[model samples]
Structure formats: C-alpha cells, structure tokens
Target: MSISERISALVGPASFVVAGGLSVAVAIFAAITIERRTIEDVETVLAADGIDWVLVSANGLQVFLDGTAPNEVARFRAQTGASAIIDPDRVINRLDVAAADTAAPPRFSLDLLRNGDGIQLIGLIPGPGGDEAFAIAEAIADIAGEAEVVNMIESAELAAPETWDAALAYGLRALETLPRSKVTVFADRVEVEAVGETREQRAEFIAQLQQDQPEGVEVVLDISAPRPVITPFTLRFVRDAEGGRFETCTADTAPARDRIVAAGLAAGATGVIPCTIGLGVPSPSWGEAVETALEALARLGQGTVTFSDADVTLIAAQGTAQVDFDTVVGELDADLPDVFSLQAILPEPETLASTGPARFTATFDAEDGARLRGRLPPGSIGQSVQTYASALFGADATDIATREVADLPQGWSVRVMAGLTALSELNDGQLVVEPDLLRLTGNTGDTELVSRLTRLLTEELGPGENYDLDVRYVEALDPVASQPTPEQCESRIRAIQEETKITFDPGSTEINDTAGEVLDAIAEVLPDCLHVRMEIGGHTDAQGGEGMNLNLSQRRADAVLNGLLARGVLVTNLTAQGYGESQPIASNDDEDGREQNRRIEFRLLASAEVAAAAGDIDDQPRTRGGILAQGEIADWPFEIRPLPRPINPDGE
Candidate 1:
C-alpha cells in the first residue's frame, strides 16, 4: 500500500473521533445549564409565594423540595407553587410537616374585695413574668387612695385565654369604683356584689357598669342598698294652714306601711309620701292608731297629730273651735288601742313678737360636723339635751351652745331631741325649731334621707304638727356616679384592639366568627363612648385595584358599624370611613404587613366642625340600610339602577 493512502485513512478516523467528543461535551454543558435555570426559577417562585421553608434544588429534569413545612397544607402549597414554575411530573416534595402543638393554655381567674379595710386581690395570671400582676397592684394603689393591696396573685408561664386580659381589667375597674364590693373575674365573665347607699345609687352603678363592659365578657352585678332602722317607730300627720304633711312615718310591715300611707294620702297629704318600714314598731296596731289619728286630724280641719311608739298625741291648731277639738279628741282617745296612750291639747293662741316664737337652731355639715345653738327647757332638760345630741351626732362631731328657758313649750324637750335626730341624717344642713314649727334644710348623698328624717321627727313631735323640708341630692358625693369617662372608654377599646384584632374573612368584608368576642367587648363600651364622636376606619393592603380596595374598606367599616348596632350600641356618635390603600401601617409586600394593613380601627374623631373643616369625614348615610346602599354601586359586579316611581295621570 502507498504511504499517502495510509495517512489519509488515519486522519479521517481521528477527525471523526474528535467531532464525537466535542458533541458529547456540548450535550453535557447544555444539561447543566438547564438544571441550574430550573432550580433558580423554582426557588424564586417559592420565595414569592412565602414558601421559603421548602428549599428547592434540581437533578437533571427533576426538582426536589426538601425542608420542614408548617403543616400538610403548607407542604402541598409549596409543591404546587414550585410546579407552577416548572412541570409537576419533574418535582419531588421531600418536605415533612411540623408536629401539632399539644400544650394547653392556662386558666385565668381573679378575686377582688373592697371594704372599709381596703382592697384584696387573689388570682392566677398567664404571662412570661410577673409584670401583669405588678401592673394590677399599681393600678389598685392609684385608684384606692394608696389602699393596701394583698396581692396573692400567681403568674404562670403559659398561653392565656382570649378574653383573660379584658375580664381582669373590668374586675379591677369595678373594685376601684365600688367602695364595698366583692368582684369575681374569670376569663369570660365578671361577677360584682356591691353595697350602695341608696336605691338610685344602685341603679346608677348598674348603668355605669353595663356601659363600660368589655366585649364578650359577661357582667353580673348584684347591688344592694342599706335600710335604715327606725328607733321609735314614729308617725305624724298635721292639717294646719299649709295643708297636711307627714313629718315622719314608719311601719313594721308592707301592709302596715300601705295603710299608714293611705291614711296620709286621704288626709290631703300631697304627692308620694314615703313611709319607712323598719325593724322597730311600738305595737301591731301601730298602723291602726296612726290611721285613726290622721282621720281625726282631717275631720278636725286644723291640727297636728303625732305617734311615737305606743304614745299618740293630738294638738288642736290655734283658732280651732273648742267644742270641735273636744269631740275629735274624745273619739280618738276612746278608739285608741290599749297599747296606745293619748295626749290631747288645745293650745291657747298667743300673740308673738318678731323673734320667731322662741326659735332654736341646729346645723350639721360634712366639713364642720354638727353644731347646736338652741333653747332647752329648765332643770336637767338642758344637760339631757346636750348628752342626747352628743350621742346621736357623735361626740367628736357635736358642739352644743344652749340657754335654759323656764317656759319653752308643752313638749319642748321632745321637740329639741327630735330636731337633733333629724339634723344628724343630713350630710350638710340646718334644723330650725319653734314651739309649733320644725324645719330642715340641707343636701345629702342619700336619696331617701328626707323620708327617714320625716319618720323620726313625726313620731317625736306628734301627728298634728307642722314641719318643712328642703333637701337636694349631690351626684359627686354619690358612689354610683363613679363611672368610666369617654376618654377612659376609648383607651380601653384601643387596648383591646392591641391584644387581639377584629378580624374578617380572607379577602372579604364579612367579620370572622372568631371576632365575636371582640365585637361584643366593643359593643358594651360604645354606650358610654356614645357621647364621644368616633370613627370606624377600614383599611386594606395594596393587593387590588385602588378603587376596589377603597370600596372593600368602606363596606368593611359599614359592617363593623352594623355589628355594633346589632349589639344595641347607639350609632349617633359613630361614623364609618374607608382609607383603602391610602393608609398603610406596614409594607404591603409581605403577608404579615398586608395583614396589619387590613384592619378595623377605632379612632376618636375631632369635633364635628373640625372633621368637617378638614374634609376627613365623608358624606354618607349613618343608617344601616343607607350605608349598605352607599356601597352597592361599588360592591356589585353589575350596574345598579333605581326603580322609577309611577306617575299619576293628572300630576296630582
């Protein structure tokens, strides 16, 4: 064979071999590039979808997702998200879901007691430390005049129930307001048992409590008023020139009280006269004697009649006919029960000078205590009066300055003692006494003080006597008026929102059922806050069109307003506004940020004038139906039209 022919054959075969090696290298490089691009794309897609926990990598055509997912749904979500960037057949999910949490939340409870001694708190609280307990102690100290707090509260390092904080807060507030109370607080309810000074005060306390109640927590209030015990069981009726009035009235039973009251009314005693039914009664026939005496006074046409225990006294008025007085007194004395004794007097009319009929005055005040500058009868009567005054008005509180009078009156000692007793009932007032007239004028925190004084004075002075009363009720001194203000109510609502949000369904304006408690808590507080102008602001994330977001937010705000209305909150002071994508508390790029942006916020609006001037307030209807109508155009997918009204033929 020739040399050239052999070289050419070897060259051709080597070239073919080199070409095959290059082809194999090119194919390998292309495979590596495709795998790298696939991995990058899958990872980018997973991160954007918030599936970063499921890590992405690729082997040739196959992409592997390997990491611990939060749950089965999360794992599936990560796989599906990754598949969207590539092919589902080429993706392998090696993700394991984390185990479900099994630890139980701790039960929270509180017991608060407030009395003359001070305040006591015993409870269980959930926390990472004892800060919550410390806050409670500090709050109690501030509210109760540095009152001693026996905080036996224990702190547990566990998750708290949803309503624990709110219930505890309400219980503490109750303890602060009520002077003598026992409050029990659980995660979901609060029970209050308190003593009020009057029936009106009890009602006021209930109203205040119900107004400031937290959402979802139940408030049970059992308030009571202290009943005054009548010492002498007295009744008095007088039919003088000023018409008939009961200076004081008392009965042992309801039936007895009704009978006595009826007799007073029949005798022309004006308005609703309160007859105190107390522990002491002189006799079972006390009502009978009182009725007979009142009827006798009414028939006599001019006189005063008084009943003190079993003793009955009838004094005929000046100018009453002597013959008429004798007949009435004779009948009353004869008709009286055996337990009762009668004193009948037809006083002789006397010409008096301008000194007001030998007047004596006593004064009682919260700031100055009690002072007596009154005339007393001769002998030990003066000393006895001083001693009696000291006992009834407290020794430290009483100061007596009196002059002895030989001829004071027939029942002068009785009148002095009765005046002092009546004076003691006033928080601040004065008592005036004369031979024939008794007068009391003052202001009291007690709503029933006038009735009580009347009962005491009537029995002491006898039925046909005359007396005047001028008492006023002061709310500042009233314990029942210690209620949370509008500012405090707003602060409480803000605190509640901080702990837990009023959440809604995903991508919808409908409130979530889990938000029931939150809504309830807010509803309870709204009545007190009604005096305060407020705005319910609805906000949204930057996930949708600006118009759609605006409309959605407005609807959500309306929904909250409706929720409060359903819970019996008056909406006159409330307005709803939608900020939409305009107000972003956090960046809208992340799930948590978006979540924070999508919220229902309660804001105290400026005065109507200010809000209107600033143009922050929108022109929308306040009613539920009208508000719903405002959103109809934005919420509905189709166009809305108003129905045309039918026209009459003659335009009548």
Candidate 2:
C-alpha cells in the first residue's frame, strides 16, 4: 500500500505503467499547447476610432468597432471576428450592434389651414422657392406616411382701408365732386353709382377718380350700378312742301331736348325756311302757290327749299307777325322769279290802305305751268301741255284739237281713231308703234292752232298737263303679205363621187367634200323646222386597230355634229355615234368593200323610243321549229330549191 507499490500495482506492472503515465502526460500537454497557439494566432482587430465591439451569440464571436458601418457589414464582421479561436464547426453571428441611425434629417410640416379647413393643393404652385418646398413636402410624406398639406399663405395684400368712417368720408367727398353720380367706398374699394341720366357721365366720373388717386392705396372697383340710357329726341314733317298745310311732329316732350331746341332755333330764325306763299290773295290756290315758289327758287338758282318740323315753330319771337305778302312777292321777284309768280289783287280804293301787303301775295305752281305752258313755241305748246298734263293727271289727252282750231284749213279734215289699230304689226303678228308716225302726230297742227288747242284742252282738263293720243288716220295702206309656211327640211344625199374628189381617209369614216354642196344644202334646210334631231352614224374600214378605227369613226361623226353646230344648228338636236367595222355592209378585205364600210349616213331621229326599243332586242336569234339557232340570221345564206324532180323526162 505504499506509493511505490500503488504506483506499481498501479506500477507492479510498474514498468509498463510508468511508460503509460509518461505517454498520457505528454498527450495532455500537447493538447494545451495547441489551444494556446490557436489563441495567439487570432487577429486583435482594433477597429478605427468611434467604432464599438459587437458580441455575436449566433456564432459565438466578438466584433471590434469602426467609425460608421452598414448593418450587414457589422453583422458579417461580428460572425467572423474571432475566426482563429473559434471551432470550425461552430457558427457565431447572433451578437451585432445595430447600424448607427444614418437615415435622412427629419422633415418640417407644411400642412396648411385656411378658414378652419385643410386646403389641398393642385396645379403648379406659385411662391418663392416653391419647387424646393414641394420637394421637401413630398419627401416627408413618402418617409413618414402620406399626410395632406393645406396652404394657408396669402400673397396678396388686403384691399380694405383702415377705418370704415374714413372710407365713408372719402366716398362723400368723391360724390360731392362728381355731382352727377353717387360714390360708395368700402375700405379702399370704390364704386360709382350714377345719378345722371347717361352712362357716359358715370364712366367719366369713375375714370376721373382713378386718375386723381395716389399709389399705395389699393382700390377695387365695383361698377354694378344701374346705368341710365339716354335716347335722343326726334322730329319729322310730312307733306310740308307739296302745296299742303305745314305739319310738325315732336318725338319727346322735354323742353331741354333737341326737338324743343330746334323749335326754339326756328322761332328766332333769320334765314329762309322757304315756305309757300299762295297767290290769288284773299282766297289762295295751292297749285298757284307751288308754281310761284318753284319759279322764284329756280330764278335764284337755288336747290329745292322745303319746310320741315324744324322750320316751323309754335314759339313766337315777334309775337306772330302776319306775313308781308308784298315783301314776299318782291323777294320772289328778286331771288326766284322762275319758281314763283306774283299777282296783285286789286283792292277797292276805300280798302286799299287797310289791305296792307295782302293786295300782292306770292304764288307758286308746278314747273310746267310756270315755264312750259305758254312759254313753249305755240306749235309745241299743245304737246308740251298734254305730256305734262298726263304725267300730273295720269290720264289720256282727248281730241281738243278740232275744237280749238280757230278756222279749219280748206280740204283738211280731222278724224279720230282709238283702240289697238293705232299700233303697227310685227313679223310675229305682235303689235308695235312706228316712232316716226307717233312723233308726227305728237307734233300735229299749226302754231296758232296748237296754242289755242292747248289752252282749250287745259281749260277742259283739270290742273294736270299730260296725255295719250288716240291716233287718227288720214290715209290707208294695203295689208301686209302673209308669212310663208315652214316646209319639211329636204336635202339631197348625193352619191359620194358627186360632191367630193377625195376619197374617205383610210381606216376612217371621214369624207372630204371639195364643193361642200351637201353641207350648203343642209344649212339651207336646217332653219325651217322648230327643231331637228339629226343622227350622224359613222362606219370604219377594217384595216387596222379596230378600237382606233372605231374611235376615229366616232371623231368623224362628232366633226359632222360640230360642223352643223357651227352652221347655227342647235346642238341639242344632233347626236353623232360610230359603229366601227362591226356594222360593215360589204366585205371588209377589198378597197370597194372598205369604201362601203367607210360610208357616213344620216337618219332623222323619228322618236327616242324607237332607238331605245332597237337596243332592247338582243342579237340572239329566237327558236323556231324547235331548232337551236346560232350565228346572226342576218348573215344566213339564201338556198335555192333544185329544179323540181324531172317527172316530165320519163314522160317525154
């Protein structure tokens, strides 16, 4: 039981035991040495300043610090920081310091409130640095979740003035100065209310106020006041210069208006109103008044003078003085003798002084009575009077010539006729007048006879001086010849050789006629009928280009139609068409065949329906005797029956 015995028992097999113990001690030491070597091999990663250690439990590793780092980079370093000491089989990533909060700076709120309500902004914003503001707001909303922004900022200054009383005082002063209007002011805002009866005055007042105001005082204008519309007064006069009573019309009753103003002007007028002054004093005549005025005005070389509402006034400047008839007559004589007549009324000697100017009043009549009646040459007097009288009276003149002749010429008798016989006949059986005959009749009779005739006619008639004559015939003539009947148009269609030396052109239907006899004949016959529809049909020779030949034939037909039209035939009645070589009447291979094929022919269009019906009949043949027909029957050969079987030969 001693140490050695234990070591041996534990070492009695001591020699073997001692060797086993040494081996076991050596194995333990080697294990500790390997662990220490691994510890020394590990890197002491001292991170850059401001960095911290991160213990990661996930992989059992300690990570050192650095300035700033992303979360993912820090985490990876924590997992592998003590890589040399860690067992290869174990993971250590659980402990990592969260990355420093490197997010952007916090945003400011731009939420705006207006009138106790949130305002949503739309459209392009207007403000200084507005784009930057919008960008910031948008970024905040994106980062901190969507939040509405309401803009409450106002850029404009208030238009209201400081004190209401001050504004009212300003308005009162404005109104005082603009007496034509009422002025209203709210704050610095001004409005004009017009009291005048015109929009022009209201506009003028507002414009004046704007011009007088100084800067820095903000003004808003409300021009909503009712505007006064002023209409001008008018006056009209009718029938004032037609030898009728003077009439006046007034549009408005206001004495301050132009209608009344014009009337006032007339009352004090010094110039001529050119009013009518009647002749035959004591009992004036309208015709005489018109004539006298016109003559007097004409002699003065003045234009027509007329009285209007402005020329006559109810207001009296001189207390309604009576017109001085003598002075009016003298004035007419001096200024317008051609347009006026002056007649003096012979007053009884006892009443002469009392009559005043009434004894000689100016008269006026129509121009004919003044200048054309007795003033014309005596032979022309009757016609002149009649023409003017008819124009004035709108009636025909009667045969006062016989009644007015002082003495009839020997063997010269006057006769009167009426109705349509006075008119001559035209070729169309229409009646017309011979101008020379009418002129001769219109200038009828001797000079003295005409003068007497006119006076008598005018006395019989009323005041008018116009008339139509019933023609009286002194001689008779034979009746006119009758018109010829319209014969049916006829023209010779000559053999082609007769009219032209040249032959038809090759491949064409055009014929050349040196004499042009056929064309002349056609021209002579064409005018007889009311209308003639001529059909010119052309055929072409079968030499070349069927289409070209057909077209050429058509051109030839059209040439004929053009020729007829040029000769004055109506184009509506003519038609030209070509049939080409398809309608050849003779063989097309020979010259003679081609000549026949190239013929041009004419046909009267008897009726449009006949041509239409011919087109409706299809070229195909109808079945007969149950046989199927082919080819055009028009080209079928005629068959001659053989001589009757010779029964007579055996009998002979």
All candidates: TM-score:
0.40, 0.23
Model 1: CA > 4 A from native: 1-229, 352-357, 362-421, 424-428, 435-438, 455-652
Off by over 4 Å in 2: 1-423, 426-487, 490-504, 507-517, 586-590, 607-652
* lDDT, each prediction: 0.73, 0.34
**Model 2 C-alpha lDDT per residue in residues 120-199, reported as the tens digit of each score:** 32222222445333432432232222334443332212222234323332333343334333344443344544443344
- Report the C-alpha displacement of residue 541, candidate 1, in angstroms: 16
User: Mind giving the per-residue lDDT tens digits that candidate 1 earns over 1-652?
Assistant: 6999999989999999999999999999999999998988888888888877866778889989899988899898888898887879999989899999877665688888898878888878777776566656655665566566677889888766777766776676566567889999898899999999976677656765665466788889998776656767667675767788776677888898899889888998899887777777778888888888888889999777767778787877777899899898899899987899998877676655424547789989877888888688867878898899899878998887888888777787888788878778777889888866788898877766766676666656655566667677687665435445555766889888988898888777776776778999888787755545566888889897766777788788889999888888898777787767766789999999999998888765522222222222243212111212211111110111211111212221
Residue 23 CA error for candidate 1 (Å)? 99
Instruction: Please give the TM-score that candidate 1 achieves against the real structure.
Output: 0.40
Q: After superposition, how far is residue 560 of candidate 1 from its true place, in Å?
A: 30
lDDT of 1: 0.73
Candidate 2 clash total?
48
